[model samples]
Target chain A: MNLGSLLDFTYLSFIDACKHSLYPYLPKRRSIQSDRVHLEAAVSWLMKSIDKVDGNGSSKAYRILNGWMPPYPETSGYIIETLLNLQDHYGDGKFFQAASKIGDWEISIQLEHGGFVGREIGVLSRPVIFNTGMVLLGLNALFDRTREKRYLDAGIRAGQFLVECLDENGCFVRNLHDHLIHTYNVRAAWALIQLGLLSGSRDFIEAGRKNVEWSLGQQLENGYFLHNHFRKGQKALTHSIGYVMRGILEAYLLLGEKRYLDCLKKTADKFVAIYGIRRRLVSELDENWKEVSSHLCLTGYAQIALNLLKLFKITKEERYLNTALHLIDDVKLQQPLNRRSEYFGGIKGSFPVYGRYAPLQFPNWAAKFFIDALLLKIEVMRDYENSLIDKLSLGRQ
Target chain B: MQELAKHHEVFAVFGKKGIWDHLDTYLRRRNEIDVHRRHTLAPLLPASHNAHAFPGPVNTLRFLRRLGIPCYKVSHLNGAASVDLLKRLKPDYGIAAVDHMLLPAVIDCFPTLLNAHYGNLPQVKGRDATEWSILLHDHLNVCLHEIVERMDAGRIYLKENIAVDKGDDFEILRAKCQDAAKSLYLRFFERPEECKNLYESNEDGKNYYLMNWELKALAQKKVERR
Candidate 1:
């Protein structure tokens, strides 16, 4: 069972879907019509489920779900991210204006609690840790876009909210839930770590440290969770491995703790061992893999692998870097050949086809992960250059 | 008879050795008729410089005693003891130059408590005497007036209009003013009673002014104008 091959196939399928679905949204030169169609379909699907409640009433379940989407602060953070990418490719102010609109929306939606409301309107609304985390990311993006202290202040507030919500043991409590345990804790932890690094706050750093420790304690000996109650036993399914791996990888990235990395590596190894890389590749086309075919999930695994490779380079550990490079190469190779129209530049299987699966659209989450992976690669390249210089100097000495 | 008249104790109060002592030396050289000419000059010293001593009234009183003159060598006396010392000294006349603070009326009215001002009467009355003249871009003489409750509003004992160069600073103008005032003092002493009522009665007619950074800047502009 070649798990690497399976991941590669999955990566290719996902990329094809993204590129095809997201194409129409991009410039004609960069258009992947199929990807754009898929993305639009997903957005439409999500929008349909959105509860358009009156300003006076409690929001519906639809609203709750829609509210959970990115650009939560109604700010142009997501838009800015898009614009930034586009600006790099094409120097244009239209993209900047789009980014600015999103930023304005974020500022408009800021809540009195120094945390943003989860939904547009709701009496049942309490501060959700995950929503706050997303808002923090958005505010950070806004700050980068504008270099305004107001955006920084908003980011700080969100970061502070996460810090304040930590329990004595450093774990974040998921509010208004029957069970306090949830993956939101991992995200909140990750957010705190990012905020700490950005603002140089000791409290945020300490909170992150605590949450990372709690996450480590939650992992089973098999490197898989028995069940993530928040996801409601979703981990028992085929896609569960990817979801939990995402959290683990995030924790590892945030803390840079060896245990988190070791835990993720062990889990990834198990996933590969069970599915086999070849079977995983076949699974991308398999009907059963449709639900998990999103580029976001695939990108998450790739990002972990890439980050681990970075860690390996620094530690001079061959296995870590090898595994990361292998995953990247395998994924690159398995990408669909004729995916010129996919949203994610040839990634497929993100969206439902004829109601069989989710659309192969460019989900904001997927775009974020894709961008994250690209940035990680760039960082790796830079590090490689530095390492080359060091090696040459050592040779001379 | 002249030496007998000069037998009365003479006291000279000054601060900052170089300029103050220089003025004192000129006076000493000029007042040759006085048989008993006493000078009391106290150098301005910070509190930290005399840590072992009380460094305030005690040191001042001690310095005054050491001078052996009836006059006090009070250093930095902006307090109650200065008034007490003035009452104790009960000198026939008190004079001040360079020290710009107004003495209390209780001390000012003590028979003769005259101050040497560097500006002419009815004009250039306040600070930056020569600089003010330059700023007004006027060629005028410098004069010395007695220190009254209203400053340059005091009765004018003697005055001399010395032409000042446009480039002169407060210090240079001050030196010239002091030299003129010293010479005036000698002349006034010769016939003190004559100029006793030299000032006009109406204080409103007197020019009162203050020197600050803005005025200094204006003075600089005038110099640049020249």
Candidate 2:
């Protein structure tokens, strides 16, 4: 941590300590606004993020000291869903246009082997499995919307690249993050499954299933997956955990596998239990499900909230919905309403914006997840209210 | 302890006590001063209406022991010693007296763990729930639910709506909630099966955090006006 960050850490710590005792004297922080308002602001920030990359893709992050960072193809690949959802929600043509541009840009950068590179664009690296799968998500979404042959072709190529990286054990060994097998590759597996469903390719579906099955083997009795972090022997960030969870959940949805649902529910139940008891979740957790880091990973909270919402849709469980709402509200508290600042509306990488995970930057993926959660929250609330109305109407009869 | 002991075998397990350093003392004193400074609302009520005082664990233990009820202290409720204590005792159920997050290690010991939340849940959760309920929803409630790992997202057994009658301040509302909680606890011990009606509160309700003084004052005014 830098001097400014150190000072920030100290100041935040002091404030937290004094908050309960000196509650009456402290400056009042603004409470959370409506979801619609936050959604609009977050979407605006995402557009600015895309604009920073010349409308080709989304920037990796917006640093406080530096300006906009380079475009990150991995995150930009999945951001297509957000844009398309926004288009459908607001009936805005521009969002669809932006989504198309992003999809096109991802296809433009696809390596000859059909895999996308890790990290920001312009980095000299081999095609990465996770990145390729992420891009394939956008391509598959675009093909589903438009039925464009190029998008389908590109998605197939990306799916093939991912399949090639997978070993006979259903684990991706080549082009892995840090060249180690990651349980989070289940997210890649989710994308491949989507591609398979979109193109009606049994081989892609089988590859996706194999990876999920292998990833499932890594799960401990307590529902925590080993080898979930970027580097081995490190505590897994809630970010990676969210990725692994959402992937498995998506796999469950597409493949119609009871085991996948059962596995995810076990883990989700564990997470819900911990979060319920403590009323707080740390950014990093060890395999034993103990807190290894005290900092709040804001991005992870958003991603997990999204995952919980999806879980609620599958199981119709109130606990999942309630937890997801709480997580979203927690993330919303971190969002600043300073419209004049350049970083306004963008979700910070960490609480206090100087914590361990992606410190000192407003990651584009964070904003992407925040937007997705907010949109889903609205949908969930509407469905619930509509169901209530329907029930009330039925009672009159 | 006196009230609970009348119906069921009562015991106490206080949270891990901490040694106060100079900074801790200072913070506590400063907190007291800050709270006293916000005494503008106190005089609005009658002088006889003193809010419930939260005696520390030592005092509480003394009070319980005076009543001839067993009292135990654990450094950490989730610690192995606490687990061993529960294993040895093997109580039918465990009821949390204070707001402490029990781990699965400790929770698994009891066939059923119970908690009385200060506000109607699924809607109002987290800190300052009573105040948030009054401020946001214009009413206060108490939820008696199973102690699940997920914060207040537990299977609610009973929801008793506390009337925010005119002249009720924050303290009175809180006292009412406590009384309601006591009644619910007694009901549970008398006929635990009646608490089996699962109240489905699955809708996504806002988990409120601390209420700022401005909002607190507004909620107070709402209470007084009601």
List TM-score (chain A only) for every prediction.
Answer: 0.59, 0.93
Q: TM-score, each model?
A: 0.42, 0.71
Taken in order, the candidates have interface RMSDs of 42.1, 9.2
Per-residue C-alpha lDDT of model 2 across residues A1-397, encoded as one tens digit per residue? 3565456446544554454344333333346788888888888899999998888999999876566889999999999988999999999999999999999999999999899999998874678888888888889889999999999999998999999999999999998877787899898999998998889999999999999999889889898988899876778888998999999999988989999888888788777767765545788999899999777788999998899999988887756766787788778776767797677799988765667788778899999999999999888867854654554457557
> To one decimal, what is the Cα RMSD in angstroms of model 2 from the true structure?
8.2
Q: Would you list the C-alpha lDDT of every candidate in the order shown?
A: 0.48, 0.79
Which tens-of-lDDT digit does each residue in A52-108 have in candidate 1?
221111112211112322223321233245445544534766445555555555666
Candidate 2 ranges beyond 4 A from true positions? A1-30, A389-397, B1-96, B101-226
Query: What tens digits encode model 1's per-residue C-alpha lDDT throughout B1-226?
Result: 1221265466544333355655554543332111122121112223443352212233443455465544444443444555566677677876665434555644553687666666545654654455555544345455556566764676666668765655654544554565566666666676677767564432433232333233355455544333
True contacts kept of each: 0.00, 0.00
Error of 2 at A273 (Å): 1.8
Over B58-167, each residue of candidate 2 has an lDDT whose tens digit, in order, gives 45567778899998877768889999999888888888765446788888888888888888687876666888677556567898888777667777777789988888
Candidate 1 Cα deviation (angstroms), residue A134:
1.9
lDDT of 1 at B225: 39
